[model samples]
Target: MRCHIFTRDDWGKTLDVQETECGSPEEALQLGSAGVANQPTEVWCGPRRLGRFEPERSHGRPLPRLHALLTLAERRLHEREQHISKQETLINRLKREGRDLALALCVLDTLIETQKTHLHERDLIVAEVAKRFG
Candidate 1:
């Protein structure tokens, strides 16, 4: 391997290389990398340009889509139901507004689910037994 070392001052003018080697560039770097001076080497920003460095970015937190949508829907429905119920109650006291009140109640009833009752003789017996045991 052979390496040739060349240095320049602020103006990028060619500087002197101490040793000569018949090796590759890697070997040349190793050979010339002796007790190197602790001085900051000057850069030739006039002729050659140095690329800008970019740092790693920190990622932000993610939100759940389904949970967000469900929360939004619940809030909207809750608001709508409150408004309609107020209107229905207002119309209830005044018979002239019965038609509008009924409509509002209908809408509210549709929005609210009815209670479901499902029971069998065997399930009732089991419940009764559990109640007696308690």
Candidate 2:
């Protein structure tokens, strides 16, 4: 059987893709596991996924620190999203009352930028989790 191994970096970016011949799916899985020294890897046969391997440090153990950080990031991202929603609602209400929107719009813009930062932080954490716990 022909197998393809995909090696990914800590950020889930594909660093390399290699093709190898294996006798079976087990051989493909072994090949993938052997090559996963410090990165995450995936083995595939045609359109079927054979197996996935992670670094030894995270082979079967969960990193409490990383999990906590991911939870915090997700919570912060959700809070920011809620804040943006409320800001938009407030802006709409003020507009309906024929009040000045210049300051409100500026605040909304700042909130949006902050939300983007939160989203980026959450994405980074998610990628890290994927790399460690694939």
Candidate 3:
């Protein structure tokens, strides 16, 4: 479960959330930074609610893991991250299309399909890690 920072717009009445960057679960899975001093004490989760949230702490007392994701947040975040990664690959391939100019460009589309296969793998790893800490 990754902890996300969200804000609300008064005029539009919309909640804004800063999503984490999508990176490989195999790569360095960095967590979010903890709350800092003098920042807004309250977070906006939705249009109807604005309040302070007690971030769950790790067992290590004062030392918490980077991003503490709620159960649903974890799953959603994972999928979004994977999508971002796949898009990155596709975009990179498209950039080369001008030079390559080949009909087999569809192979680039397969990159995302391969990513779907890895979803369950990442889920297992994340689940195990979460169970260990949570």
lDDT per residue as tens, model 2, 29-104: 9899899876789999999998889888635335765676577778877888888899999999999999999999
TM-score of each: 0.26, 0.52, 0.24
What number of clashing residue pairs does each candidate have, in the order they appear? 4, 0, 2
Which residue pairs come into collision in candidate 1?
A: 1-23, 1-24, 2-23, 2-24
Residue 22 CA error for candidate 2 (Å)? 64
Q: Each prediction's Cα lDDT score?
A: 0.40, 0.84, 0.43
Q: What is the lDDT of candidate 3?
A: 0.43
Ranking by lDDT: 2, 3, 1
For model 2, the superposed segments whose C-alpha errors exceed 4 Å read 1-62
User: Model 1 misses residue 82 by how many Å?
Assistant: 0.6
What is the lDDT for 70 in model 3? 35
Task: Give the candidate number with the greatest lDDT.
Answer: 2
Q: How far is candidate 1 from the true structure (C-alpha RMSD, Å)?
A: 28.1
Best by TM-score: 2
Give a tens-digit lDDT track for model 3, residues 5-118: 443321123245554433432111222223322222233333322344333443422213223323444565577667667666666776777545243345545655655645
lDDT of 1 by residue, 1-134 (tens): 32334443222344453435434444444444441342112222224322211222233112242234335445555666676577566557655644445666665565453211112322443454455455
lDDT of 3 at 66: 20
CA shift at 85, candidate 3, in angstroms?
0.6
User: By summed lDDT, which 10 consecutive residues of candidate 1 come out lowest?
Assistant: 52-61
